[model samples]
Target: MSAESLERQTRSYLSNNVPQIQEHGGFFEIQDVDDESGEVTVAIGGACSGCGIAPMTMNAIKHRLPDDLDDVSKVNVTRAGGPRAAVMPTKTEEMEEMEEYKDYSPPF
Candidate 1:
């Protein structure tokens, strides 16, 4: 198959066959399609960007992509940002907890 066809097929299959991805708001933009190596480089964005379970999503896509079609040797999912945002406790509760643990420290 031609690289252009493979790229289009990749997008179509992901949008259709992967219902879980669709439901989870998985947004994938095709960065580039390599015909020589049959590799699809996708940028993972939106909810999947900040999600903790994004690795699972990428894995699912990786394993499933080949199953859905041929010529796709690999799926490369990468994050543009540094990392997912950390979940922090409320300010007041966090302050109280900090005060409680203020004196507690690991002795080197």
Candidate 2:
């Protein structure tokens, strides 16, 4: 899918699911997603940061989001601070940067 649509759907999925995590005393805010790889890097903050159950939660996210969002094939949870709105990427600028150089080759 195009990066724009991917970002929109991803944000929607996360918006739907984040509250569930919040109820468990933790949070999952998307830091980045490599659309080409379906790899999602999320910052696990709040009480989940040092919680022993963080892995379990991470596992749940990895297993669950993909089932919910078609584009989600993988999930990588992490620790971060601040608010969720501030943490989530409104667009896939991270992926677009790589595309800018996709045709690059040495002139030599």
The best candidate in terms of lDDT: 1
For residue 95, give model 2's deviation from the true position in Å. Answer: 33
Write one digit per residue (lDDT tens) for candidate 2, span 1-108: 765666677767766765655775666666787889777777777666555444455555666778888787887765577653223342322422455433433121
User: What are the clash counts of all predictions, listed in order?
Assistant: 0, 1
The 10-residue segment with the lowest total lDDT in model 1: 80-89
**TM-score of predicted structure 1:** 0.64
Per-model CA lDDT versus the true structure: 0.63, 0.60
TM-score of structure candidate 2: 0.56
List runs of model 2 lying over 4 Å from the truth: 81-108
Reference-based TM-score of each model: 0.64, 0.56
lDDT of 2: 0.60
